[model samples]
Target: MRGLLKLTLTQMKLYLREPVATFFTIFFAPLMLLLFGAIYGNEPSPLFGGRGSMDVSVPSYIGLIIVTVGLIGLPIGTASAREHGVLRRFRATPLHPLAYIVSDIINYLLMTVLGVLLLFLTGKLVFNVRFEGHLLSVLGGFLLGTLAFFALGYLVAGLAPTARTAQTVGMVLAYPMMFLSGATIPWEILPKGIKAFAQYIPLTYVVRLMRGLWFGDAWSQYGTEVAALVGCLLVGGIVAAWTFRWE
Candidate 1:
């Protein structure tokens, strides 16, 4: 337990020390919100199911943070550590490989939570967007979605031979998920074929579940979404564990 705690703290420190990571963690969502919110303003729009654009934008941005950290940040960081021989060196130590990966998961989860909170608060204060729905329900869906994406991250990290490869692969995977999953583009306004395709995307389920939970949809209303996320979490976790290497 103590070893895990120490490793988690060390991971957090190392990640935060990177300038790009720090900037994105702190400002990415807010900047995106500010840019769009300023243009769109805070009027109730039929485009966003009658809620203000910021309302949908806030939850979608949170989902983006989750996917971005899990897919892009984690894979690149883990692959870089492997390229630098950090994971290899740790193989000879008392620390188990699971502990190392778990620490990374914990560190990134915290960072994602921080980013979500910041975005939510900023939306409320600046854009006058109010959080709807049950808080606990929203958190449950968010955490489940986080785990699903994190497991996918582990899979990418395990497969990529170098940080650059991870970055390339991560971008290819993450961008599609981001754009089609309603993280950047509203799922409602998407074409019928695109929406049909999105139904198969795991991130689509996550974004829908999150938006529903955030904005007054019943927890029971998102059973399919929740089930899809859980399925991805299990499948991705198994693949990641099977493929994982110390170096």
Candidate 2:
């Protein structure tokens, strides 16, 4: 346990040192919120069913943060480490292999939580974003969505032959999902064709589930979204476990 904690802290420090990862995971969403909040001004809108723009935006941006870390950060970091023989070197260490993997997971998860907290703090302090849902429910939904995407990220790292390939694929998959999943733009304001297309994107489920929970809806109301995210988690995790390589 002590070894795992040390590894996790080390991994976190490395991640923090990466400029792209730090900016996207920790600062990007909050910056977007500030930019849009300034433009939209968080007025209660009929489009969002009387919720302020910031109220709806804050939760949706959580999905954006998840994708940024899970799709871009995790895959690129894991694959780069593999390409650089970092994982192979870890195998020679006294600690168990599982410790390395667990530490990576812990590092990413803690970073994600920190990013979310910063986002919420920014919203609350600047825009006064309202939170109607119970904190536990929102937390549950957040974890589910995060894990589902993290599994997909691992799958990408496992399948890509090189760090460059993983980065390419992750960016390709992430950019479209960001725009179409209602993570960057509000779903209600999107065109009908775009909305129809977004239903097929996995990130859309995360956005929908998060927004619904944030609006104080019961879990029962998001049965489909929950099921879809669960399916993603299971399928991605199984495939990633099979395909993952240490070197």
TM-score for each predicted model, relative to the true structure: 0.95, 0.98
Which candidate's TM-score is highest?
2
List lDDT for all candidates, in order: 0.87, 0.93
Worst 10 residues of 2 by lDDT: 97-106
Candidate 1: tens digits of C-alpha lDDT, residues 119-201: 98889999989688888989998999999999998889888877899889988999999889998888888899999888888
lDDT of 2 by residue, 50-160 (tens): 989999999999999999999999999999999999899888879887788788888999899989999999999999999988999999999999999999999999999
- Give per-residue lDDT, candidate 2, residue 18: 87
Task: Point out where model 1 deviates above 4 Å.
Answer: none
Residue 32 of model 2, lDDT score: 96
Q: Cα lDDT for residue 133, model 2?
A: 88
